[model samples]
Target: MGIATVNPATGETLKIFEPLSAEEIEVKLALGEATFKQYRKISLEQRSQWLKAAADILERDQRKFGEIMTLEMGKPIKSAIAEVNKCALVCRYYADHAADFLKDVPVTTDGSRSFIRYQPMGIILAVMPWNYPFWQVFRFAAPALMAGNVGILKHASNVPQSALAIEAILTEAGFPAGAFQTLLIGASQVESIMKDDRVKAATLTGSEPAGASLAATAGKQIKKTVLELGGSDPFIVLESADIEAAATTAVTARLLNNGQSCIAAKRFILVESVADRFEQLLVEKFQALKVGDPMLEDTDIGPLATPSMLLEISQQVQETVTKGGKILTGGQVISDRPGNFYPPTILTDIPVDSPGYSDEFFGPVALLFRVKDIDEAIELANSTIFGLGASGWTNDPAQQERLIEEIEAGCVFINGMVKSDPRLPFGGIKRSGYGRELSIQGMQEFLNVKTVWIK
Candidate 1:
């Protein structure tokens, strides 16, 4: 797709943006490198003040930003507003803690004095996604800017307005124009950007193919890169779990962002003893969801982010059914809708070879599997090629401990849903992608750790 905002709710093209030409991209890149030289000399206190002001602006105009997000990406207005607020929280978080995170660490050594200094790497490129446009970019920009590194955002093509809005917010909050910039560019232009020596390390959050392509290209340059890719996260409920609570949270976990989240639970594993009950609850809840315009206050579900997304999800569900997976609730697309709307769906009795068994269903669809015990639960949970996150429910201490230690995912929530927090390290292993974002680890991803010693 080209750089433009096409409303996913009504299939309306609200705005169009031209891709930045090669010359324009060069200007921004030169500015980023030049700004980094001066920006890194600015006091941490000054950077902190600017970032804190960003938080203030985000809070002041959250509703306006939220509408931009919803109009571009089809997330509900309430959730979109909440996402903007989260952007503010992350700005404040890094603004308050970045100085401590980047402080020189005194090392005990044979030399008279030794320490490690954290320093900025110039022009960090952020390849963000459309799912959580504002949150994803801020999580990267807040720390990068606070650490005195400039940023260049190559956001998803479909959310051009959201991308520009982010650049505007940062600039309005007293950041120099070069400190952060949005490039209205397509996927084809990314390789050229990475090839530029001025652009240092890079970070991306998107599909496996996109992440792999970027990583491969960056690897050739011997440059550092962080990737947060696809996930088929499992949600397990054992015999001892609170069926009611697990069932309730399961719906939200599966349908968040219209079921477009990478960490949203995709596979539901239930102990045979509770499988029937949990399955019934899930079906009832799925059938009860309200699917309509995302801008409506009472709508529970909205359109998929794009028509291609809608088509891919429908094909996956159909293939699963053809492979012997039984649908307990929704099994077809809502043809009456003018936009990309798919109802909440539940697939059970899945064969091992079905898409429901292994593929990450990136829509409002849930795959249910029945296991005999905790051993089966863990085994089934770890069966997927993706291992981004897992949410397990159990009251037994031993079972909980086993789930925590045995589950092969980056994150395991014992009794709740899997969600990203600004204070915690977030990322995954295996096919889900590598490296980390958020927390102290994320702040240091693109920094140079220099060691100094004195005899």
Candidate 2:
């Protein structure tokens, strides 16, 4: 089957491209391997220059590319523009920092001049999601290329133009032909590509099932894999938290990427004393949001990336209501809309067995849970299998310390929302998927940290 770009806003198939044939796949694999052999030999300065050039190209035409992202995936135009700008920031960040990050580390050993050198392997396969189309690919490509490895991207099929746009940027920025490439094949084709000996490792950012399938396949081959999967991140608000600030941030955190992001706050666990006020503030904010076309500059919430996402989220909300939950604000699909549009929704008093209690809401739906105290809040927050990220709001030092120590998430924010930054290592624990992304740690994930000893 061929890949196509279907606009999430109108449910229209805008473009289609045939999947790569066996011969084409072989050509790319050979090119990836051959390119890595030559790329790894290139100077850090040269790679850095190209990365910067890519960043420059992105900055110059971010709006145009941002529109493409909005058209394909239904991200609000403003947020899409911000996403494209952020990609450029990541490119520049890796360009400036990769050398220092990969420099040799001196180690004490029996050998006089003992050190550890970081070297690139070969081709890396990145199976990325379409939520933040440009951001996700650039984050991987910038570091992978800067570290002297080639990347072959199997981006989510929904955003085929985005997949190709990335390759074009790298090409126009003066990178070698095969340094970075996008494969237009479907998910079924990913395993065969990964099984190839030329592809050294794989990194995925998608559903748990997809990550598991890819990881298992890679495991059988003993090829390393980095998986960033689902997250049911908790936004915990304690009695001492500034309820206003916490609730305000919660709106953005929960509805980020039209509530399609893996890291978006899904479960809001609130202490009893502050729950009512926080709930009131959250509802007010949700009601104030403008839900409309992704291309609209003023729209705060846009359509879900696909119609299936709309159906799934609607069913998730219905299940919770049936299992003893109350819809405080919005919880219905927009029937008149042509696109996959679901209004901002809030579900309160969700029972323990309700789907809202455990399942991740992949749209603009928020699950609110009331807890007796910080202890109950922490317990409820840690109950999920996903330990990706958590945001705790509290002014009490002891409570803050407890939140930081007790939250099962890989990353915790005391007062701010959980977000990915180039300076910080980002990833999750447990079922949220393994390994890390961003920072020096992310750059080192696919590198060979070889120990060098001198007599």
Candidate 3:
């Protein structure tokens, strides 16, 4: 299949490219392996300088890069620019911190003097998604390259231009030709690429099925894999929470990235006392949101990345409605205009077996649940198979402690929205996928933790 960029807003094909042939793939693989040998010997200071330069480029041409992302993936223009800026921040973060993060750790072992040395493994394969394209890749590449490992990106086919732009950014920043390359190939080609001996490990940020396939393939080779997959994160509001604040945040929390984000709050569990007021506030806020072209600065929500995404979320909402759920706001696709525009939606009185209660709704849709107390809220929040990220709003110190301790997620935000930060470790648990990304833990994911002993 040809790799192409089809505008989600207009359903028009803007650009297309041929997938790499077997011969081309072989050459890139060989080049990556060869580059790793020499790149690994380069000093930390040099790598840091190159990474800093990459950050500079990102900041200098952020609007250009931001437009590429908005056109390819349909994220709002303002958010797209923010994503590029975040990518630059991560580059600078790793550039300044990788040396300390990877420094030898002196250990008190039996050998006269023992220490743990962190070293690059080799060429790493990154299977990334179209959503947050720049942010995701840079978060992986900055540390991977800083630790001396090279990267070969097999980005989502629909975002080919975005993918190529990333390689150009790194190359312009002075990274070696093979130090970071973008593979313009289809998903069918990933298996063969991963099987190659030159590719040492892999990292993926996408769906659960994709993550499972990569992990299984790498498991056979005994090569490592890190996955950041789907999430149906919970947003809990108890009786003590400031209802006004929680509802305002709930709008943005549920609809960020047009609701394509894995960590965007999908399920909202509220105590019965505040449920009515919170639901009213949510409906007003959702209705106030503007749905239009992603390229517009004032647009609050945009099209789903693809038509299939629109169909899937529509079906999910219909299923919930069929199973006794009530639609408090939007429930239909905006068909008068072109593109995959979906209005912000809310579903309440959801049945136990409905998609609203169990499945992840990857669009501008929110599922609301009411519970009698915090006990029921916590129990309902942990019901899903995904334990990625969760947000809890409460002022009572007792409830705050309980929420922090009881939520079955990798990270829980009290009185705030769930988000990923460069300074903190980010990932999920259970079906949300294994391993971590961002911070010190992320940089170490593909490194070899070798033990050194001195006589």
Candidate 4:
């Protein structure tokens, strides 16, 4: 099947695109290789200038770009706008910091002048997801481009328009022709791209299966790969937490991006002393969210990005309930809605052995588990196979310190919500995938760390 954009809110096909033929794929790959040969020779100052221009274009056309994202992926209008702005921020960040980050470092090598130099690899294949269409691609593109690596994007099939728009943005920003290209192809086409000799390394921000497939392919080719895969992040609330604040933040954390984010809090582990009150507040908070048309400014939650997502989430919730879980609030899919809308669901007493305990619910559903103490909280939080991000709510300094030290995640937010920032390195440990993104570390991911030794 070719790429198609169906408005998730209305279940209408807004646009469709035919996949490129084998000839077209070869032509683009040749162009990308040709572009990288010249593009990598450009000065850092020149690349920075283009990146800054891209940021300017994003800020200037945020409204238009945001609408495209919303129309294609069913994100709320406000969130889509914010996503565009965030992409701009990342562009600006890499533009400003890339030179410093890639600077050569002198090393003490046996009384001679030796240094390590960071240089770009060849064309990189970026297999990106559609949950945060614009943000995800830009996060990869900004850093890779700044590192002097050309990119070939294989964006999720559902967001073809966003994928094309990104290529346009790069061209408008004065990037050399073929510096960045979008491949409108399906998952089946990725292996061929990976096998291309010009494609040096690959990075993926998607599901576990996708990550595994790409890693396996790249592994056989001996090409380096970075995988940012799925997460079932935990939100732990201690007895010392500011209950009101924790309760409010928990709702937003679990439901951001309509709960499609891999780092979005999926499991809630509340200390038993405060479990009763916290659960009460959580129910109240989730029940008050306004779910409707994503185009509306006031909408707090929107439909799942696709019908499959809705069905999967619904099945997970139903399975959890059947396995002795309790639904405290909304559970059924919304009625009289043309879109893939499921009610904000809260499940308590989910058995630790149930599938919901390990699965990342890629929608607005939160599982609650009452813990006896801080030790139990941490145990429950770390029980998942994914370790992308975690949040702990507590007022005690010692408790906060302990949780931060022990939480097995790429990021830990104490008494606050977890989020990815352009300034901070964002990536997960364990099954959540490896390598950092968006900071000085992110800029170095696609670079060649050449070590020079003087005789």
Winner by lDDT: 3
**How far does residue 410 in candidate 3 sit from its true spot (Å)?**
0.9
Better of 1 and 4 by TM-score: 1
Q: What's the lDDT for candidate 1?
A: 0.93
Query: How would you encode candidate 1's per-residue C-alpha lDDT over 246-324 as one tens digit per residue?
Result: 9999999999999999999999999999999999898899888899989987888899999999999999999989988
Q: What is the TM-score of each candidate against the true structure?
A: 0.99, 0.99, 0.99, 0.98
Clashes of 3: 0
Kindly list the per-residue Cα lDDT of model 4 for residues 1-455, writing each as its tens digit.
Answer: 47999999999998899998889999999999999989999998999999999999999999999999999888899999999999999999889998889899999979578999999998999999999999989999999998899999999999999999999999999999789999999999999889888899999999999999999999999999988999988899888889999999998899999989998988999888999999999999999999999999999999999889988988888888899888999889886879999888899888766767878899999889887999988988888789999999999999999899999999998888889999999999999999988888887888899998887
Q: How does candidate 3 fare on TM-score?
A: 0.99
Question: How high is the lDDT of residue 100 in model 3?
Answer: 96
Model 4 residue 51 lDDT score: 94
C-alpha local distance difference test of each model? 0.93, 0.92, 0.94, 0.91
Off by over 4 Å in 3: none
Model 4 residue 230 CA deviation in Å: 0.7
Ranking of all predicted structures according to lDDT, beginning with the best and ending with the worst = 3, 1, 2, 4
Model 3 CA RMSD to the hidden true structure, in angstroms:
0.8
TM for candidate 4 is 0.98
